[model samples]
Target: MKILVLRFSSIGDIVLTTPVVRAIKQQVPGAEVHFATKPGYRSLLEANPYVDKAHYLNSSLRELVQELRVEQFDFIVDLHNNLRTSLIKLQLGVKSAAFDKLNWQKWLLVNLKINTLPQVHIVDRYLAAAAPLGVHNDGQGLDYFIPAEAEVSLTTLPAAFQQGYVAFAIGAQHATKRLPVERIIELCALLRQPVVLLGGPEDAANGQLVEAHFSNRDAEKSQSRILNACGQYSLNQSASLVRQAQFVISHDTGLMHIAAAFQKEIYSVWGNTVPAFGMYPYRTKYHILEVPGLECRPCSKIGYEKCPRGHFKCMRDIQFEPFFPAAPAAAAPASQNRVG
Candidate 1:
């Protein structure tokens, strides 16, 4: 059987679909799996062995349709139920199944705050879309294959982190979903181990602030153990750092899902959005740190430029004690070690 799976952009959403792709390849006899995604995300699926082919949507709908038509896929699994995917499926005219995005429920929750949505995680919902094809969740978590070239050596990391370190994803697409710089500094101060801050170019400024904050602190009292790699490394190299970490602490963001792919212990911080939205880390043991009993929580399905309410108590009021037992100690220093 020739099967085509679709999930276009976004890092976390694409990572969440790995299980579905794996199940389709492993369970379906003689299956040839193809994944269609935006050209930019090709690297995300390039190293995935289960996918026989990776199709990039580089041009107009007509172009993509013509290209896919030549492949003659027996079925299409539409994990992204957006207008673009709809157009693609309509153009292909193939038997297709799409995951329930619960758009109406999300709309009601975001606009009306009605809690009628199911508590199921999004990954399970993605898998449900493939139920008709006899694909089952294999109990394995998300998958992220970092190419050998992207792997980083532990020796290349600072000396203090060589023994072990916590990977902290200090960035989010939306400011409301992210903890403020002060809050991040507070959390870092509380951690008893070394920490490596991770994020993209948008987060580079915040990373600099973090580094500077630690640098100005009294080095004798506490060791400055934070390494800012935001915008410095590629996505897969960040994944390599995540794989080496003893634990991961992050907000509701893409790196949180990437940590899940590594099966690392994750402490996820919830802000304007809650895990009730079902996009939390999949198939990994995790602890969610959110302010309970806040009626104003989950103010948005995605996130806001800033907290709509202004107070932003959801993230501001959360206590990090439960997530980190002992405050992180000062890092020893920089040293070179290789990470496999």
Candidate 2:
């Protein structure tokens, strides 16, 4: 059977769909799996072994649809479950199953603060999309693949990080989703071990601020311990860093999921959003840190540029000690190729 799986964008969301791809390939007989994602995210699936073909979503949906029509897939698994996927299912006119996004449950929680969400993780929900195909969750957890050539070498990083470091993801898609710069600086300062701040080009400034704060505070010390890697590495390269770290401390973002793929110990900090959404670290060692019992918590289903309440107590009131507890005396050697 020739099967088409669709999850359009985002690093974490796309990564969450890997189990479904693998299940259809392994469990079903003679299944040729093709994955369709955004143009920018093609690399995420191209290197994946389970996906037989990787189709890109071009600027025009009509153009993309035409491309998929020629392939003539036997089944469509719509993990995205948005309007775009709906249109694709209509156009393709094929037997399909789609993930239930639980939009109504999320709305009730976000609006009325009512607890109606299921206890299941989003991965399990995603796997449900493939149930009609007789596929089940293999319980192996999430997967992220980095080609040998794309892996970041130890030499590329500073000598301080070359030995060992805790990967600290300092940026999120929204301000309300991440801690303020001052709080991040404090969090980094409290960490006992060497630190590597992770983010994209957009987060370079915040990474710099954290580095500078550490520099000024520890100027009398000998070596430069904090390494700001924001904008310095590609997404895969950053994943390579996360793969090698002893453990990861991250805001609610893509890297947090990437860390889970590596099975690294993750300390996930939550802000306006709560863990009830079921997007927390999947099948990995992790901890959730958020202010409990706040009436204004979960102000939005997604996040905002700034806190609507203006207080931002959900993030500001959080303490760092709970997130990064005391570490062991001796550091283990860093893994050469931790990326899978």
Candidate 3:
């Protein structure tokens, strides 16, 4: 069977679909699995061994539809329930099943604060869409593939970190989802062990700001401990760093999910959104750091450009102690590779 699985855009959401891809390949006899995602995310899927082919949506929908028509997939699994995927289903004229996005339930919860959504992780919901094809969740959590070449050499990072350090993802897509710079500085200051800050290019400026704040306190003392890797590494390269870390401290972002893919213990900080949305670090041991008992929590299903209610109490009031604990007397270096 030739199957085409579709999910478009974003690092975390695409990573969540790994189980579906794996199940299709392993359970379906003679299955040739092809995955379609946005052009920028091709590398993430390309490195995945279960996928037989990677198709990127770079141009017009009509153009892609024309191209895919030739391949003539036997089944279409739509993990992305957007209008674009609907259009593709219409055009392809193939039998397809889509994951329930729970749009109305999310809308009711976000707007009315009524809890009607099912208590299931988004990944499990995604796997459900494939039930008709006899695909089952493999219980392996998510998958993130880092190419061998992208691995960061121990020699490249600071000598202190080469031995071991905590990896902290310091950025999120929305301002409301990230911890304030001052809060991050305070948390890092308390972490006695060496640390590495992880994020994409969008986070470079904020990383610089944090580095400067740390530098000003005691240039020689603090500067050597915190390394800012934002903007300096590609997505996979950043994943390589996460793979090396003993544990990860992250905001609700793609790296948090990626760290889950690595089965690294994660301290996931919740801000504008709540884990109630069911996208928390899947199948990995994790601790959630969010200010409980706030009625205004989870103000949006998807985060806003800025806090909608303006108070932004969801993230501002977090207590960092529970998340960090005291650093061990003898900290071990992070792992460079996964051992089978």
Candidate 4:
């Protein structure tokens, strides 16, 4: 059977669909699995062995549609459940099943403060789309395959981090989801371990501020303890760093999901969003850090560039003690090192 799976964009959402990809490949006999994602996220799926072919929406949707029509796929699994995927399925005219997005439930939670959403994680719902093919979850968490060239060894980093370090992903798609600069500085100062900040080019300036703050506190120690890696590495290379970390401190962002993919102990800081939306880390050891019972919490389903409410207490009031434990006395290898 030739099966095509659709999850158009975003790093975390696409990464969450890996189980479905693997299940469809392993369970369905003679299955040739193809994944269609945006060109920017092509690398995420291309490295997976279970995926037989990788199709990217590089240009116009019409172009992608024409390209897909040639494959004559027997089935289409629409995990994105958006208008774009709908158009693709309508044109292809194949047997298709889409993951339920639970839009109404999310609306209720965000607008009316109703708790009608299901307890199931989004990964399980994605897996449901493959049920028609007799596929089942194998109990594996998530998949992220870093190419050999992208692998970042400890030796490449500073001497202090060579032993072990925390990967702090400080970037999120929206400002409200990230901790303010002062809070991040405080958080870093409190955690005694070496920290490597992870983010894209857009986060470079903010990363510099955090580095400066660390430097101002203690020049010699900050040099070894903090490394601003924003805009310095590619996505997969960043994944490599996350894959090797002792633990991860992250905002609700893509790297958090990547950390989950590697099954890293993730202490995820939540602001203007909550785990109730079902996008929390799947099957990984994690702790959600959020101010519970804030009326304005989850003000936006995704997030806002700035907090709609003036105080922004959701992010401002967060404390770090619960997420991070005390660091070791010296820069040494952590006792446990287990990764997928």
- Model 3, backbone clash pairs (residues 3+ apart or across chains), number: 3
TM-score of each: 0.93, 0.95, 0.94, 0.94
Q: Candidate 1 lDDT, tens digit per residue, 206-293?
A: 9889878887884674556888889999999999999999888899998999999998877788898878789877777677778877
All models, RMSD in angstroms: 5.5, 4.3, 4.2, 3.8
Error of 1 at 149 (Å): 1.1
lDDT of 3 by residue, 74-95 (tens): 8999999899999998999999
- For residue 162, model 1's alpha carbon misses the true position, in angstroms, by 0.9
Candidate 4: which stretches are off by over 4 Å?
A: 220-222, 328-340
Model 4 alpha-carbon miss at residue 90, Å: 0.6
- TM-score of decoy 1: 0.93
In angstroms, how far off is 174's CA in candidate 4? 0.8
Clashing pairs in 3: 163-333, 164-333, 164-334
lDDT, model 3:
0.85
Query: What does candidate 4's lDDT look like per residue over 214-251, in tens digits?
Result: 77766655364788999999999999999999888899
The model with the greatest lDDT is: 4
